[model samples]
Target: MNTNDSKLREQIAYFGRSMFERGLTAGSSGNISVRLDDGWLMTPTNCCLGNLDPADISRLTRSGVLVSGKAPSKEFFLHEAFLDRRPTDRAVVHLHSTYATAVSCLPDVDPRNVLPPLTPYSIMRFGKVALTPYHRPGDKRLGDEISIVAAEHRAVLLANHGPIVAAKDLESAVYAAEELEETAKLFLLLQGQRPRLLTPEQVAELERVFGEKEDDRAKTCC
Candidate 1:
């Protein structure tokens, strides 16, 4: 492997293990992918994130052909949806993290923005997380839904499923995914007990200052 590819392989394994150990995802319940100059590197299907070996991570050509390593996750198009829509995004992380999945299953939460703005980090990292109506696992149409929303949002919650996050790089994607989960945990914890949420003005100010560009605020407003 080239030096850059070698480093990415190690990083992917490290973060995958960390996510597994911290219960961000349970056995074989999550997948991660990173865009490469040549193509992409993705976690294999039905493989425990905690047990990933760098050499076994699947590599794909720019045209989506498998080039090396194990088979790619069945949700390959989900990752592709985000990367194709957002050219700046270099990594995607999808996880069935406990609290976030719980939030997805809620009946009253706004599908337009699944998590409430309990903290600035969540807003900064995720913007507004769009919710895609539930689709059967391995459904290719799910990618179409994700592409529509991901064009304007960096993160999205799949109804009755989990959260998929895209970011500038793998570490940022991982951090944003963790932040989404923590915010979801807080959202559930404070349920029925009115928690002080960041006002719309506060959220707007955060987006103005920390968002990728001024136009991002306009494009991402729900």
Candidate 2:
């Protein structure tokens, strides 16, 4: 592998350890993947994020065939869906983070945008998180659902499952995922209470500024 590929592998491992140690993921309940010109580098199936082996990360071809190392995560469909649709996003992060998953379980959430506009950072980072209907883990069909919302949303909360964030790069995806979790925590905490959410105009301004900057980055990404 070349220098960039080696660096991505190390980065995936490094961030995986950080997320796992901080309880963003439990056991092997999360997955991460990075885009490569030829294919992808993904965390392997049944592997704990905290203990990733950079050398053992799976490398797949452009057509999704495994080229080397371990087998890709069963949620391979999820990663491939995001990277394929979000051309500018370099990484996809999916985590069974506690609070986010709890929010996903709530029956009253708006299916279109689950997280209330609680923080500008959340809105700037997530755009708006779509709430996808429940699908079994590792089920290929879930990718289809993701594809429908992939172009418009930077994140999706899988009903009864967890949250997935796609970002300009691996680190950004991780941070977005963290923000998602925190936002979820706040959402839950504010239940049955009056919390001053950001007004629609405030959210729109954030989208116009930070969100458009992201769009600009996408334009020059290639």
Give me candidate 1's TM-score against the actual structure: 0.94
Cα lDDT, all candidates: 0.89, 0.89
Kindly provide the TM-score of model 2 when superposed on the true structure, using C-alpha atoms: 0.95
Q: What TM-score fits each model? A: 0.94, 0.95
lDDT by residue (tens digit), candidate 2, 16-53 = 99999999999988999998888999999999999999
Which residue ranges in model 1 land beyond 4 Å of their true spot?
A: 213-222
Candidate 2 clashes: the total is 0
> What does the lDDT read for residue 74 in candidate 1?
93
What digit string (tens of lDDT, one per residue) describes model 1 on residues 1-222?
A: 788887898999999999999999998999999999889999999999999999999999987789899999999999998899999889999999999899888887777777888998888777788889889989998999998898888889999999999998898899889989999899999988988989999999997787856334323432
